[model samples]
Target: MTPNAREMSESIHEQMPRLLTELAAVVGTTNVLTKPSQQQSYVQGALEAVTDATVAVVIPHSLVALWRVINICAAFDVIIIAQAANTGLTGAQLRMEIMTGR
Candidate 1:
């Protein structure tokens, strides 16, 4: 990875716990998923070539919670991949490798 990318990755790793906690507070602990198994459905797209690289899948049930999540992500400079219904054919919903939320 590029130096900047690597640095960002390391930063994300270090701050993950706090970030997750903040996210859980905004939504709920049960809604934030860090496990690959739980995140598979959100990260996977229609194309087989696309890989799942998300750090977490956050399920916000309300518009307020979603906005809070977005704000938090912006604060951390975390990349966001927004998926709706998980049915996009071009994989536009699965491009980023960081936060995935809906």
Candidate 2:
């Protein structure tokens, strides 16, 4: 591989473990997963019920873990998409999304 590719790989390798460790610390070992097989049930959407999410899922087992996850996104300024149960009429989750940027 090229130097740039190697550097990128190394960076990802370093950051991924750090983030996973942090997540596992906040949450528990059962909630922190890297295996697709174990997480297969959770990957589905409520609406579709079987629509497999293409992204990683972090299920916070406690309030502290949830807060840490939120803080991490805010601190990093990541553009996040928050979804709620579709049972609501409309616009319920939108308010939370708006306040998240602040």
Candidate 3:
């Protein structure tokens, strides 16, 4: 992708907050995270993969917010990664490692 396309991609990503806010009508202005730093980290790889999951992460305090986030991602055809647990090195007793869900 060229720089112009990259700029357009970023602009599209920037609209997620408005979309999420529309879905989660109960959320206040302060609850939404418009910046990347406000989000949490999501890296627990075992092979020392410095996976820069450097994206905004919104933590829902209630079921409403969670539902809203899910709805927004689904409507936008976005990918959601859900992690259950990490066994450090042992791969036993692990039913599901990570859910690369929709």
**Top-scoring candidate (lDDT):** 1
Better of 1 and 3 by lDDT: 1
lDDT of 2 by residue, 2-91 (tens): 445446446555676666666677677677667777655444434543443222456786677788977865554333344434443222
Write the number of the candidate with greater TM-score, choosing between 1 and 3.
Answer: 1
TM-score, model 1 to reference: 0.78
- Over 1-102, each residue of candidate 3 has an lDDT whose tens digit, in order, gives 444545645765887666656644546555655454553333434644443433444456678777877777677655555444443532222223254211
Give the TM-score (vs. native) of candidate 2.
0.50
- Of 2 and 3, the candidate ranking higher by TM-score: 2
Give me the candidate number with maximum TM-score: 1
Write out the backbone clash pairs for model 2: none
TM-scores, each model vs. reference:
0.78, 0.50, 0.45
- What is the clash count for each candidate, in the order shown? 0, 0, 0
